[model samples]
Target: MSFRKILVANRGEIATRVVRTARALGYRTVAVYSDADAQAPHARLADEAVCIGPPPAAQSYLSIPALLDAARRTGADAVHPGYGFLSERADFAAACAEAGLVFIGPPASAIEAMGDKAGAKRRMLAAGVPCAPGYLGSDDDSDERLLAEAERLGYPLLVKAVAGGGGRGMRLVHGTHELAGAIAGARREAESAFGDGRLMLERLIEHGRHIEIQVFADAHGHAVHLGERDCTAQRRRQKVIEEAPSPVVSAAMRERMGADAVAAALAVGYVGAGTVEFIVDAGLTHYFLEMNTRLQVEHPVTECITGFDLVEWQLRVAAGEPLSAWLPNGQADIRFSGHAIEARLYAEDPYDGFKPQTGRILHWQPAHATQAGRAPGAAASSVRIDDGIAEGGSVTPWYDAMVAKLIVHGRDRADAVRRLVAAIEDSPLLGVANNGRFLRDLLQHPDFAAARLTTTRLDEWAAAGAPLLQRPAPDDACWLAAAALAARGDVPTSAPAGLRPASVAWQTIALQCGSDTRRWRVRLAGDLVEFDGGPSVQLLGQEGHRWRLAIDGVTRELVALRHAGGWHLAHQGAGFVFTEPSAAPDQRRQADPGRAHAPVAGVVAQVLVKPGDAVSAGQPLVCVEAMKMEMWLNAQAGGTVRAVHIREREAVSAGALVVELDIDTVSTVI
Candidate 1:
């Protein structure tokens, strides 16, 4: 390759992923980080790192000038816009070219052609590609004009951002009454997220499967599609899991879709990596969705099945290599191997509307075993974990909530699912509420196992109360293990002396969950730990965070960590936090039941309530924006606002009181 040094202009797993591959290919890599990510793993992994700007993406990662300056200072000859941030921004690509930097992506014109969803749909229709029935004309974007056209398009419409993807600035309108609101909300979100207030309307495919073809191209005008990735497993349009060699796609259908996808790439004169997304109905008919003009977050799955390092391909192509050079056999020789699945590990609470969470990672353990799953043509099964954070690293509110990408490959779909579930249970990402357990349960769901997933099915399943979300609770063994571990500390002089073992001190430990605490006296009993009035538990082995314990002769392996003044335990796919007892109970959580609280740390986007305003139950009192998500805090009960503690555009911590309501003296919080 001509380029010797490359700069990865993104964060999280995508950045690290690019860096690892580029470095392996003998290219020096530079990583750019914001102030908050000074200690991020991606930064440390790069040969050189640069501080671009502040935490917020607009002031840092999205700033083209800052990125180019970083590349210039680092003497980087190539720039890799890894997904999100400025990956699809045509201006960024153009600027890189202007600065004599090889943009390891499609040309600026290609990005512009495919970046706009409306424009891409128009071009696809002209190219004879099947497109969803919707409105993509630029006749007008006024509320009245959109409403009139939407009326013609009919109900259950999808409002999508014209400039970007990832379900941002997208909303589903099921009725005419919601069309105007959806338009406004989508426009505002689009403007905030992509700096574009434009939108397009699409007919909602409620029972459709989301499939995207991974396409690659070269300067020689040759392109090929890397089959399809079944992204049907989604929640609220956000992909939760993605797999390759879709369970539903037949060989004939794959061939047809692959041709169409390759045509879509060539239509835009695309070079480098891109994805052509499609929405397929139950009848096996597919419609063109928007195209992603840069690398995808779930590219690992396709790489695993194809045995191609896509980043390496992008690099070689950017350096003027043709398709024949990178692909020795070309498209005709392409092969799809074992099934590969990728599950996104996000720092979010699935039970609480999947709200984004922020915190320092107290403990980070990636699942790796001598036996897991193998890559294409590998000797044995192994696990793949692409993460950009480490222990003590913080998951801030300025970026995407995803902490890592856990990918696995197996001989078949069932084997992939089984290994992925065990992988999720084995990896522990503590100090932040996450969806690990929820993903495990989801993978185990019969509908998912049977390839019965659709775009709206996950949401429908949750709304119908299928109970996919179950909060973690400690069982007897876990409780005893936690107490016994906590008892290893010195006995406090303030407490009365209890029964003592020969060498190990007998101590009382209080393990608190929420407002309840389970205090127990534990003492060492040979190889077993005896609870004062409960059964004795024998700890067979204690490895790093993995403990093998036997209770009543029943053996179990649990992942536990005593960090950040608490015990983070995982048992049977459920995660629990049992904190040490505080000298005094927290008065904040005990006091205000009618207070509107921020669910996560974020900036106050808007304050809808005042000190004396009257609010009804569930009325939106404030809007908090965190990790690019706008969350509205609602009132818990009908009452008069007694006080407002936050202002618009001000930062607030998690559980910070935003507003107080004086309701009939009853306890309630939201």
Candidate 2:
């Protein structure tokens, strides 16, 4: 039953991954893309490509009819929904089957059973699987009853949507004071994300480690577990970094978790690649959180450790192959060789609440010597990068912000972390803001190195105002900018005409970054540049964006890229930006004192204040949702709302005016 052609019904890196495996299996591949992804890498990699619809996911990737029509036209006999979008939708899977196309995933019934968090927990309880203590009862149909249930669960707990995955429609309630707000917000978000507002409760396991087992099954009714991955490094309940063969899991715990994961998968008569997720508490007690009924974003780490392509297994299993043919001895005593860690390179600003960024990627470079698509060797320092976008690609606000997944392999955990750090040091993504530096910082933290990571670690770091979150000093920024400009031939070629190198007057240079603006008086003479009353700088040479230079007898290499009429620099896993002061956008803000603009690019989820309404200082004027998180736009000062410029659910760019206030009437014009 091997298929002749397969239609990939997903986008980004996962799409490319599925195509790669299909090509290896000697199958023709068809790729479907939206208007925004017309020129994306995955589109070009496939043998045949078709335009699905617009940029919004609902009209394109998530539309089952569009996908079936595309498959029908392309003569594709099978459809591979790689990870997101329609990957986990039971209706989509059923539709694929109804269209006579092989769906390379679990059965529709399995997906439906596990898709609902409350139903899944009930099934797990019936099967004797250890799940977190909470209220998933069907009797609590009212919000007031749910609040009563939360009160019984005590102070700290989570309100999660029954049909939601990925933290969307999820909220944390610290106490009774926040329960109502948490429930309402969680419900709204759940309804918006999953089309269902039904929620369940769980006692928040403080400092818990997220671990999941990779399980596989086939139409032959055989299933096996391929070890586990630790995804404890998280922020806002979303995983930031993941590693396989968890450092904290012993051999005994691994076996127990694997058995439990296999049992959970078998309970629903599962098939294809699936993951069973669990939360491990401080005392090593584990509880089932949920099961993802498709391939995971962190599957590469597991592949790096096991040397088996999970996508290939997916395709093979769908072709009616038995699980024993792929998994060693039906996954009994599965062996794991090396350690691997994956870092998700997202287009978001780590410094600004990790807000999603939308812009054209002017430059993109992965930090690995070996190119992607090749299997990493057994050496401890092998690197691999799997990405969906390339240079000149755009990151829009319509989908997930992840640009790529950087994975590194090693013989052990320490070696893997070291290699990962080295790889992260060289990765440079320009044009849009990203969290690369923040991830590198977290990797090197003493607490992380000592295996102290947890679901709450990132929040703790933010609350403590960790120094790693700060940008580089202004002096360092100027030095790097000067060197980059010199390397790119942007500096002056000659000294002052009337004086020797030592007697020339300093040239004035203005630089602006983020909010701060600084002016540095500098002099450029050949490869030697001297700042006013500062040390002389020297630019040795440049290889791509990596620059080598000596400042005051010290040598260092820095990653620098020119974009948006300025230079973006990274050193020691910290990023900084420098542009001519005039290029700063503050002038626009200063031009209109009464305008309240969108702080970040996102969809306006709600408008809290209306026109002609008086608002107090710090009162929320609007709430914008971006990067899967919501942020409030507050009034700078007490004023009467003059006009509302944007509507709810409307997309707004950074600095786009959302509201205008009557500033002069609230105060004095002076």
Candidate 3:
């Protein structure tokens, strides 16, 4: 039966995506949001919006009761679980079916069978699927067994939570000596993160490529594979960039992997959109990783290559459609059109351990221009940007830190990389610390260009001192000149005064880039500009729309354009925006000292330190659990724990004081 309305039980970009697809399928959409997302883009885009609970995901996105109530109140006939949260929870799926709402996914039994990594591995091995050599026995005294298995599998094995996904609840053991500690840590994290302490072991394949095949099944027991994607470019096991039609995958290898994926899905009686992940070793041998029973974040790249909307197919399958025509004899030959690559634009700081960032998006502009060369009627053109937030939208810390997914398609991988680089160059976002520059750097790296990648690439890159591909543009010189001129009262005191030429003491300014500050001295002499202090700067005559600034006798042209309440200097294929009131102060301050606040709203999972206890910097003080994940709140500095305001399992708000520290001594370390 075709459902009239569907409730998207998710947040952020995926929620908006489901709603858009539902609207296209002539179905009304309902969106449930936490307090933090009440004004989010997804809520406004839905046909109806309901406030589920507080900003914390536990009381909102992960609350089964709240979700059921929202569905009932909004008269939604079906629910679409978009990738995370309750998407793979068997209990949630069963509850939805009991409530008379269609669960647009595989059966609950299927989820339960495949949700546990150990059990899933057993089933796959039994079904003749290639699996990594490890131990997945159900013995409480399995520590000795795991150590033995680690020895046989050699050094550097992975201890993964049986019920965990993402990179959480996982630890890498380099040798037998590290096995016990890694096992204990992995179990603790597994229990804290997934509410299950069970774990298993797998051999860590060195120099492996992260590959996955998309599988679609229907109600009629029909299934088909949608080729494979190369997600080798990753950071901390989290994929940073993804592309369709892996350059390293041979046609014969693709067939073998696709066949195995189908067998795994069929073994589970799976239906709807799902991904079967695999890790391919250097020898091109593949092993089953796990199956994600929902649409993937990188589905857009597959859609771009195949010209098929996986979400639409999911809806059709849920409505009792068959996949007979899509796949003949349980397999179909897939062809790739052009190369497609996707970059996840996140509000994060790569230099700061890839920490999550949140704030209002003051400005947003995506690159939408074609490159220099292109066939007259080629399928590739400009970039196709898909985002969930607008200019005024807030990037709350209560959810995933992804701001948008930028995808670009070109005739080949080289052209695709060039287009992606151009898109990042032309794109602009302000008032938030985003990883746009980081994405550009990763794309142009020699390692990535050579396709020699693995899951540990990002961690390895960071360990080698996080190197930036490009430096901040030389636009700071223009800002220094403007500031110096303004201080002397030579330029008219007005906003946006940099646009006009001024009679200042120095038309030429010399600025030295200090360790933490920019020191400037200026001298002006009519149209003939010259500087004496520091590096000699000579001003060349300004051409139309370009400012010619000479530094150390080298003439360089720059574009001075007004932007973001200030001026933007574009030079050397890079653009840097400078504001009058620099925000350097806020960036250097310690994590808000205004009381011991909850960094994120969640139930207090554990309180490690008591009131009045002396704590040191980097000590874990509290653990907050949200969305089935545990986040440790550490001490910002050494001090006496003056107060423990919140109890165990107590729900707290973002920035709400959970602990107070009395600092006896101040250290100059931030």
Candidate 4:
């Protein structure tokens, strides 16, 4: 049955992607969102939108009943799972089928078969597909039995949870001494995440490349492979960068892996778009890693290289159409064109252990860079950006922090990397912490350029003490000056005529970022402003409400507006509050000093301090679990804990104070 309307049961870029594809196929798309994503790009672009619940996934995206109700309300004939949440849940797929709606993915049986890693391995082995030698039997309680299995598998084994994917619930054991701890840790994590702590052992391939083959199938038993992707660049087993037509895979090896992947899909009687992941060792020995019975986030690179919409194909396949009918099977038909690379631009700080960042996307605009054949000889390279946010959108700390996916396509890998760098260098994202600079650095690195990488490369790079490329000194000074001038509403139309007397002019500017404050004094001389104890700045020009300032060698523009008792300075994609010196007394008294509050609403997994415990600045005081992700709350200042108001596993609201520290003691430490 052809679907006339589809409901995307997801959020962020993936939901946006499903809507775009569905629209192109002449199908109306319905988007379901939470309160946090009311203004998201997906909601704005969908033909119809409905608010399912609040910001939390449990109350919204992961709420099966809410999604089903939305689909029914919108008259959606099909529901696209979009990779995460209930994407691989057999019950969700079965429910959709029972509700007379297409799931737009693999069958319920296929999802169930691949959902259990151990079961999939057993199936793969029986089907003659290359499988990693490991323990998958029902008997797993005996320590001696596990030890014997580990010895047979050799040292450096991976203990993986049967019901886990993504890098969660897995532990690596290098020796027998660490085997039990690794197993226990993996079991604990698995139980906490999937509610099933069942684990299996496998021989670890120390320098293996993560390769995955895309497979498409129809209900009529016809299936074909759409080449391969290299997702070796990762951190904690989560992919960071992905590319199509892996640089490491030879044409012959590609054919072998592709055929094996197709075979694996057929073994499960799979249908629609799916991925068969594998780990290829240094010696080119490939082992099956489980299959993902849904669309992948990195599907864009494959589409770019193949010039085929996988989503469109998925829709057609779901309608019982065969693959060969769309594109005839021939040498020219199966060829991949150009190279495409995608970088997941997340709101995260790589310098701080890849901590997720959350705040408002005050300003956001893609770089105008253009490649040779991609966009002619444009001033800069043009990047294809898939994002779920717009300017002035709030990135709540409720979900994943990925702001966008920046993709670049070129005639070759080298060209793609160069274009990607140019695009990142030109992007205008401020206020929130982003890894654009780090992505650029990775693309230009010797190992990445040479394609000699593994999943652990990112962690290794971080351990090597690589410093992030800081914004040029000139640029920093320019932005600071622009912010100062913009705060005063004294934007000049042109460069200042000359210097003025410093004795008669004293401009006080107070800038507030988050809870931190900075005070500055500026002595104006004609159009030039000399900041006391800081760099000298010259007003260049003004355009509309923005003021251009030149300081130290770089030029920056800022927008100014008066709000409350402070001047709001908006620049480089961020918003800052600048207040006059005279208003400091009232502002200080009004500032909320309610201790450090929870950044997000989640269950307090652990409380690290007691009422009388002494803690140092930057020490972690609490750990919160939200959406299956763990985040630690750190102390901003050293002090004795005057009060402990929360307990382990307690549910807390965002901005709720969990601990109260003695301000007097903290001040003394400072």
Estimate every model's Cα lDDT from 0 to 1: 0.84, 0.82, 0.74, 0.76
Tens digits of per-residue lDDT, candidate 4, 547-577, equal 5777755776555444455554544333445
Question: Predictions ranked by lDDT, top down?
Answer: 1, 2, 4, 3
- Number of the top-ranking candidate, with lDDT as the measure: 1
Per-candidate TM-scores read 0.92, 0.91, 0.81, 0.80
**lDDT, candidate 3, 456-563, per-residue tens:** 878777778756622444554555443333233222223244543444554432223223335345554432234446554444544432546565566765444443
lDDT at residue 437 of model 1 (Cα atoms): 84
Candidate 4 — what's its lDDT? 0.76
After superposition, which runs of candidate 3 have C-alpha atoms over 4 Å from their true positions?
A: 137-154, 175-185, 188-193, 325-330, 369-382, 469-516, 519-606, 612-670
The Cα error of candidate 1 at residue 300, in Å, is 0.8
Please provide, for model 2 over 1-670, each residue's C-alpha lDDT reduced to its tens digit, 9 standing for 90 to 100: 6678999999899889889878878999999999989999999999999999987676888888899999999999999998878888899999989989999999999999999989999999999999999998575567899889988999689999998887788887889999888888888888777778898999999889999999998887788888999999988888899998888999999989989999999999999999999999999888999999999999988888887778888888899989777455666546688899999988887776677888887667776555344345465337888888888888887778888888988888888888888887777777777888888878888988888988987877776777866654545645545543633344332434343233345667766677776666777665677777766667676677776778777877776767667787776555677777665455463445477888878888889888889877677899888767888887777789999999988888888988998874545332
Model 1 gets an lDDT of 0.84
Task: For candidate 1, write residues 230-338 as lDDT tens digits.
Answer: 9999987889999998999999999999999999999999999999999999999999998999988888888888877788888889999998985778887688888
What's the residue-level lDDT of 547 in candidate 2?
69
Which of 1 and 4 is ahead in lDDT?
A: 1
- Of candidate 1, the 10-residue stretch with the lowest lDDT total is 370-379
Ranking by TM-score: 1, 2, 3, 4
